[model samples]
Target: MKSTITVSKKVKEVLERKKKEMEIKLNKPLSWDEFFQNIFREEEERIPKLTEEEAEILKDLTKEDRKNWRIREFV
Candidate 1:
């Protein structure tokens, strides 16, 4: 199935330019769907993944603990 989406001219131009650049670098043709998929895949790879135990610890954190954790992590 196919669907149509509307975008501003500026957004359309940017996407077209990026699509061409990615195709050249990747050495293959891509549909708009494939282009967006590649972009999303790259973004997902940049996020950190935590183990179950780490998630549990986070879930149990108090507001103060979370604030302290953010300060420590960022600074």
Candidate 2:
């Protein structure tokens, strides 16, 4: 799983800076796999992975369904 792609020097520098920023932000040095996962993984699982455009198609819902549907619930 080793490959290389050309990137501009500036782009490479930005990526390195971002890696440092994420390390400080999360209080951990992220592995390459985990770093990409954290960057690309869905931000939340509670919304069924629908984009804002996709969620606008619903035409009907139950009161309970409406009340219970949330991106994330604290309680």
Candidate 3:
């Protein structure tokens, strides 16, 4: 099976330019999937990892402490 999707020509042009920029920056050409994979991989690396102690502290936070931290829970 195959899927067809639509993109504006302007958006496609920007993506093409970005792809060329990335290929030059990395000193290698990339397939469409490779281009996006590198982006998502870098983003995942930027997110902070939590230790067990940190997870426990967050789980044990009281409503008041959570409020002070500006955390919200919808009923």
Candidate 4:
């Protein structure tokens, strides 16, 4: 199945440039789906995961504390 999506000209141009760059670097052609999948995979690997103990501790935190902790951790 195929679907259509609309984007601004600037966004389309940027994506086309990035697609070309990725295809050259990877030495293969990529469909739009594959390009997005690759990007998501790289992003998933870059973020940190908390352990079970850390998750439980977070659950006990007040809203303000949780917000502060996230700011400290991410920034």
* Best model per TM-score: 1
* Model 3 error, position 21 (Å): 1.3
**lDDT tens per residue, model 3, 1-75:** 556678999999998998899999999999888998988998999999999999888777865576678656999
Instruction: Residues 1-75, candidate 2: write the lDDT tens digits.
Output: 987889999998988888888889999998767776777663554446666665555433454478887798689
Over 1-75, each residue of candidate 1 has an lDDT whose tens digit, in order, gives 989999999999999999999999999999999999999999999999999999888787765486676433554
Error of 2 at 55 (Å): 5.6
Q: Would you list the C-alpha lDDT of every candidate in the order shown? A: 0.91, 0.74, 0.88, 0.90
- After best superposition, candidate 1 residue 60: deviation in angstroms? 4.2
Q: Give lDDT tens digits, candidate 4, residues 1-75.
A: 999899999999999999999999999999999999998998999999999999887776765586676434554
At residue 65, give the lDDT of candidate 2.
75
Candidate 2 overall lDDT versus native: 0.74
Q: Model 1: which ten-residue window has the lowest total lDDT? A: 66-75
Instruction: List where candidate 3 sits over 4 angstroms from the true fold.
Output: 1-3, 62-75
TM-score: model 4 vs. ground truth? 0.68
Most lDDT-accurate candidate: 1
Candidate 3 accuracy as TM-score: 0.69
